[model samples]
Target: MSETESRPAPSQLRRLPWSEDGKSAYLSTGDGASFLARMADTMEEGMLTTAEVDMTRALSVADEVSASRAELKMAVRFLAHAVADAVEVARLRGERLGVDPEAKETAEFLRRTLTR
Candidate 1:
C-alpha cells in the first residue's frame, strides 16, 4: 500500500503540529523566498525612483561646475562603471535564483530625458 494510505485523512490532520523532537516539522522556505522577493521590489522602487535621477543630475551639475573637464569625464566614467556593476550583479542574482530582475526604468527614464 502507498505510504499515504496508512495516514489519517486531511480533515484529521493536526494543524501546525510540532514533532516530539521539539521541531516545527513544516518549514517555510517558500515564505522566506516570497519575503525576499518583496524586499527586492521595495529596494528596486527606492533605488530607481525619479529622485535618484534627480540626485544624479544635481551631482553631475556640481561636478561640472567644480571640476575640470578631464576630472568630470573621469567621474562620469566611474559612475557608469558603478551602474554597470550593479546591473550585472542584479542580473546574475536573478539568473541564479530563477527570478526576473527589477525593471529597467532607470534606463528608460534617461532615454526619455535625452530625447526631449
Candidate 2:
C-alpha cells in the first residue's frame, strides 16, 4: 500500500511490516538499492534476531518446573508471537529465492511430526 522511497516494478513485491491501518505493506526494490529497501532489510534482520532471542528465553522459562503460572503464560505468549513473525519472514525470503513458500514450511512439518 505504501512505497518506501521509489516506485516498484511490476512484480517482486518485498513484504514489509503491516501498515498503521492494519493492512499489508509492500515495497519493490526496483534496483534493490533504494533507501527504503535498505531500511526494510535492516528491519527484517532485526525482527529475526529479536525473535530468536525471545524464543530462546521463552523456551527456557517454559521448561522450568518451578516457573510461576504467570511466568509461563508470559513465556508462551512471547513465543507464539515470535513464531508468527518468523513464519512470515521465512515465507518472504523463500519467495525471493524462487522457492515455493509452501514447499515445506518448517512450522507445518513440526506440527505434523508432533501430532504423530
Candidate 3:
C-alpha cells in the first residue's frame, strides 16, 4: 500500500510503482527491509535498466541525420518515457539516501515488528 507523495514525511516514504489510476505511489518502510521494500528496490532497478535501453535507442535514432519524421517522432516518445523513468529512479534514490542506515531506531523497529 502506497501513500501519495502529496502527504507529509518525505524521508519515510519509498517510491513504489504507480497505482492503477496512474498516480504516483509510495511505501512507508521499517528499516527498508520488508518484502515490500525489496520489491520496490527491484522495481526501481528494473526501471533504470529499461530506461537505459530506451535512452540508448532514442539517442541512436536521434543521431541519424537522415532519420525520417516518423522515426524522429518515435525517438522523441521513447526519450520522454526514459526521462520520466529516470526522474522516478532519482526520487526513490533520493528518499533512500536521506535515510540514515546507522539509525538504531529503524533497526530496533524492524526487529520488533518482524518478530511479532
Candidate 4:
C-alpha cells in the first residue's frame, strides 16, 4: 500500500462533543467548563486593562476627547456578554447536577442586574 493509504482519513478521527470547528477538542465536560471559565476571566481582565488605560491616559494628558474612553466602553460590553455566558453555563450545569440553591441565587442576581 502507498504511504497515503496507510493513514486514517481525517474524518475518521475521534472528536470531542464541544469541538464545533473540529480542529480542537475539549475531551470532557470539565475541560469545556474550564475553557469557558478561562475565557470569561480573560474577558474580565481585558475590561479592567482597558479601564486602567483610559484612566492612565486621562491623568497623563489633558485631552478630554481621547479614544481610550471608546475602547473602554467596548471592553465593558464584551465583559458583560462574557459574564452572562459564564453565568448561563453555570446555571445549566447546576440544573444538570440537581439544581444547586446557589445557582438559583446567581441566576436571580443576573436577572436583577440585566433589568437595572
Candidate 5:
C-alpha cells in the first residue's frame, strides 16, 4: 500500500490551542522554548552589561575632573535613562520571541548603581 493511503490525512492532526485574548501565544510544552528563554536571558544580560559599562565610564569621568555638580548630575541622569531604554528594548525583544528575559538581574544592577 502507498504511504499516503496507509496513514491518516493532514486534517487528522490536532488543532493548536488559542488564547482568549487572541494573542498568538505558542505552547512551549516543548524544549525549544526553554532554549529560547536561555538565549533571551543571555542576550539581555549582555546588553545590561554594556549599559552598565557605559554608565560606569561616564561616572568615572564625572569623578575625575572638577566638573560642576549640576553637570555631573546631568550626566549620571542621562546614563541612567540610557540604561532604562536598553532594558525595555531587551525585554520587548525577548517577549516578542516567546522568551523570558533576565528582568530581575537587570533591575538589581540598575538599583545598585543608582543607590551608589
Candidate 6:
C-alpha cells in the first residue's frame, strides 16, 4: 500500500482534551512549567540558527543573481517554518501560564497563515 493509505486519517488521531470553553484549563505544575520553559528556549535557539543559516546562504549567493533568488526563496521557507515553531512555543507557554484563550487562538491563526 502507498504511504498515504497506510497512515491513519487526521480524524483518527487522538485529540488533546480541552476545557469546556474550548480553552486549555490545565495549569502547568512546577515540573511542567519548567519543561515548557526549557522547550521554549530550545525552540528559540533553533529559530535563531535557521535565521543565521539563511543569512549566510543569502550572502554567499549575492554575486550570482539566479543563485541569490533561490537562496531568498529558501530563506523565506525556513523563516516561515521558524515562525510556526515560535508560535508553537508561545502557545505552550501561554497554556502553561493560563493566558487568555483568544491570544492563543490568534497565535495559532498566524502560524496557520505562515504554513500556508
Top lDDT hit:
3
Candidate 6 off by > 4 Å: 1-67, 101-116
RMSD of each: 14.0, 5.4, 13.0, 11.1, 12.4, 12.3
Worst 10 residues of 2 by lDDT: 1-10
Q: What is the lDDT of residue 20 in candidate 3?
A: 47
Cα lDDT for residue 86, candidate 1: 57
Selected candidate, larger TM-score, 2 vs 6: 2
By lDDT, the better pick of 2 and 3 is: 3
**Which is better, 2 or 4, measured by TM-score?**
2
State, as a TM-score between 0 and 1, how close model 2 is to the true structure. 0.70
| TM per candidate | 0.33, 0.70, 0.65, 0.32, 0.37, 0.39
Model 2 misplaced regions, further than 4 Å: 1-10, 100-116
lDDT of 3 by residue, 35-113 (tens): 9878877888899899999999999999999999999999999989999999878866856777566665787699899
CA lDDT for candidate 1? 0.51
Candidates in descending TM-score order: 2, 3, 6, 5, 1, 4
Clash statistics: count for each candidate: 0, 0, 0, 0, 0, 0
Q: Write the residue-wise lDDT of candidate 6 on 1-116 in tens digits.
A: 99998666643332222344785433234334365455545655676576667556555556456665667777667666656655554554444466577977897799899999
lDDT of 4 by residue, 12-89 (tens): 332332336655443223334566555644654565565556555544443445647766566556556555555544
* Clashing pairs in model 3, backbone N/Cα/C closer than 3 A: none
Worst 10 residues of 4 by lDDT: 10-19
How do the residues 1-116 of candidate 1 rate in per-residue lDDT, one tens digit apiece? Answer: 89888665643332222234785232223334465455554554554453456447547755576677776666666566556545644553444354323445665688799999
